[model samples]
Target: MTRMRAKPGRRTPVGRDSRDSLRRFVEMLAEKHPPLSLDAADLTIKDPEQVRRRFGRVFGYLTRVELEVERNVLELRVLMPESTETDRIFYEQVWWPQELQHGVLLDAAQQGFGMMPVPIDVARVSARIRVTGALSHLPGMLGVIRLLYYLTGAATERSAVIAYSRLLDGLRAMGEHAIAETVIAPIRRQEPGHFAYYRGSAEALVKEEGLSDWQLQLARILRRRSFAPVGVTSRRQRADFGDVARALHLDRDLPAVARQISLVEHELLWAQQLGLKVPRYIMAALDEAIALSTARSAAQSVRN
Candidate 1:
């Protein structure tokens, strides 16, 4: 038999022209993150009815968060009132539709599970909110905002990937393979595209604005205060982390949550590359937990 060269699978390139970057980002978002194969027998759903019931709670929360993000973008546009030719087109044609699509996808996912979609209404804030956001949009401030947005975005997307990956693992452990493959896996795949967009946009924005050390410090501070897990938010009295943790059956301990958050921060290499200023409380907790986990594994190996 003749030797043949191997072909590469479809994967996005990290460093590339903006058009290529954007295209790859979109493809990954649209196609790659979701899982295609699952063995239903491997899942742990003991009662289909209970699974169906819980699905409503999970889907409702996700839909609402998606809408909240869209509203933020819309309101930002309203406040800034984009006057530039380019800004207007970008907001009208690109950003608006993308955020809206997030809501649409979440709704579709909810409908697939026979759940009612959640309603979202943007809070009416005075122009002061816009003015503050605009001030942050100054050439210097905009660079900081863009960096924080994208870096935090990278952190957020990576967190989604990890969280969903764990969800799937739990599903498989529970023998709920169908939902894992159909619902959870698909949502996981969408994250990479979101990640790519944030990463690409951050690179472009940083380069364009010539970011400074002070600006970078500011970005980190803002990111920590504003960070929220993807597909969930810590906003409004109605939206609580406890609700999310319960729905996902995630570990409720502060250390565990901090570890998961740190996994996201580590995956994105934000702390090192971006010099992100993570909260000391989170950092201390994660450090101790990680150290203990590592030491346990090492001790186990020695015993073996």
Candidate 2:
């Protein structure tokens, strides 16, 4: 776990509007949007030679997406001690199952084309992260951490939406209509609601009294220091992320995606510096990881 420094602030009262918004969001999540059914009909790929080949790459990406559910269980525990149980109930019962099914569907698609699903190593929280979580049980720390989680979640889901949209388009262009509708479409539909929760929480929490300038400063530092693609701690995962980016032609669009992620944070922390731009660590990590993956593939070809 990454560590940082900041003074604790006072807890702020949640506004009626914010509270109402959360209630509505939670209710919406409780409402059923049934998970995708992965049957032979929906799983059918129209252009196996073209689309399935690319889906082999998409499988790499979806595995990471699905695995985040497991990681988020731990993340919810660490970031929001006050609401962990409530959030955990929703995640385990609802969100986790849906996203995990997305992984299952994608994995099935990959298997249809005879590709293996990428292995996921569930991340263990480091001592620093545990200490941070414990410290969050203190007065001011929880608010800041929770705010960071919302910001992170919003950005992550936004990026996923973009990636999935483009991937669906790519598949359709390759005449893989079934995959465009069946696999990617349902998966993409699920993400926006997740983004809405995070965006709404970040917006609401930032205005609360408990959040302070020092905590915001610490958040800025954490955003800069700790930001990376989901489940990308290891070199192998990073390489896989790189391969997916290239396969989806996302290398160019990534900077734009990073900016979208940074927008809410920039407004929260440095309104005057709204125009401020720093190198996006996520983009750099993907680029470097992709380079490593590419080199390894080339080396393997030579070996073969």
Candidate 3:
């Protein structure tokens, strides 16, 4: 059995509102939306050619990222050494199990279209992450890191909610309602809970002075300088995310989507600049990803 690594002095949060909110949400995880059942998928592929042509890339990308939840948990354990027991319960217990099921289900969906399982990176946690974990061990650093996690989680899930919705529509338009209802709908339903968990916790922390001036300042600087698109650690993955964004039509409303993704961060970290339309780091990452993806597609077309 793999040991669940944690730091000393880690405990549950003491406050009532945020703690209670998260605690209630965790309870709701099992009660509200138990792990998705791949066994129950209707698994009907209406048109293999159409499904492959329209959704294969998006499904493959989503499946690989979702399946990488194990790696994410490992990263979390290393990066948030000061995590409370509640945090552990949420990430390791509630979140991972559901997200893992999502991966399995999505893989099943992609395979239904005759596509092989997308490869996932579930083992390596990388040297850069370990160094960040080292920083997390410092005083007051855990809270900063945890908040960043919450903010990022909110943006990521929000993106999923939108993407899944678009996928559902496309599937329905193609008369692929069986997979849409069985796979896409259930997965999309569970996403908001994850988003709520992150958004509520981040909002509460921001509301209650859960951080200090210097810490907040440092957080702002780090966020502006170091922010990357969620789950993107490589140029290939970045381009894949851009493809997912464009496939889901997220690129059509980049400013609005960017604002929604970074809402909590804007309110919490960006100096009350209510007028801040989009965070430069996020928009820039997406733009670059889209550019790379477009160039690659153009090159492929030329070669063909």
Candidate 4:
């Protein structure tokens, strides 16, 4: 575990309001939700070729949704202690199964389009994260790291909500109403609550603890470097993400999407965001991924 020497700041009390909010989220979890029957019959693509092309692109990256839960659970168990048990419970009991089911449904949909699903290797928490987790056990460090976790979660889930919204629109426009209704809508619906949880948690923590400039900078740097769309973990995932963005015509709106995702961080990190639409680092990373994907596809075509 990488032991970080964070200033020993006073512990911010996790107040009753935060606990109440978590309880509300807990009460909302349903064991079974929409898209309950995602077999081959559920796919309503009028053109299977487009389905194979477009829906396959979306489904190809759903594995990250599942693997990330594993990483979150492992990291949270280490970083979140007794006071933050509600956050941990929500992830384990509510979020994990919901996200895993998303992967399953997307896989089924992709298979219906005659696309082979990529196998997901569930990620174990790595030594570096474990070390960071251990460092988070310290008093001053724990609060800051926990705040980062919530902030990261907020940004990520907000991005997911936006992507799924765009995807739902694209599917509906293509006259795939069944998918728009059953698969995309339901999954997107659940994401807002998760985002709300993280947003509320972050707001509360930040209000209570108050961020130093150094803390804000750390948050900015971490988010700038680490933020990736769902299912983006490797070079291949980046390519897949880029392919999906292009297929869905999302390439043009990425700046807007990036801006929306960075709202909280912008407020935290910059004074009036300094006229930045989105962080340059994040935009650069996305551009690089798209270029890589294009190059890869071109190379494969030449080989064929």
**Per-residue lDDT over 196-219 for candidate 1, one digit per residue giving the tens place of the 0 to 100 score:** 566665554444324566775666
Candidate numbers, best TM-score first, in rank order: 3, 2, 4, 1
Query: What TM-score quantifies how close candidate 4 is to the native fold?
Result: 0.83
| TM-scores for all predictions | 0.60, 0.84, 0.92, 0.83
Q: For model 4, how does the per-residue alpha-carbon lDDT over 44-156 read when each residue is reduced to its tens digit?
A: 66676876776576667654565456666766776655446677667777777778777677766666668786766565666756776777756566666777787777778
lDDT of 3 by residue, 1-304 (tens): 1212223443323233567767877887868888899999888997988899878889999898789999999999988877878779888888899999999999988898899987789999999789988998788787778778888898889878888999999999999999999999999999988887887777666555357766777778888777777678889888888877777787888888887777767766773566666778888987888888888888889999
RMSD of each: 11.6, 5.4, 6.5, 5.5
Q: Count the backbone clashes (under 3 Å) in each candidate.
A: 10, 1, 0, 2
- Candidate 1 residues lying further than 4 Å off, grouped into runs, are 1-13, 16-48, 52-56, 76-116, 122-129, 170-178, 203-209, 230-239, 252-304
Q: Candidate 2 residues 146-239, lDDT tens each?
A: 7777777767777788778888898788877776788888889988877776666666666643467677778878877877765567787777
TM-score of candidate 2 against the unseen true structure: 0.84
Better of 3 and 4 by TM-score: 3
Stretches of candidate 3 exceeding 4 Å from the true structure: 1-16
lDDT of 2 at 242: 76
Model 2 CA RMSD to the hidden true structure, in angstroms: 5.4
In candidate 2, stretches whose alpha carbon ends up further than 4 angstroms from where it belongs are 1-16, 39-41, 84-90, 277-279, 301-304
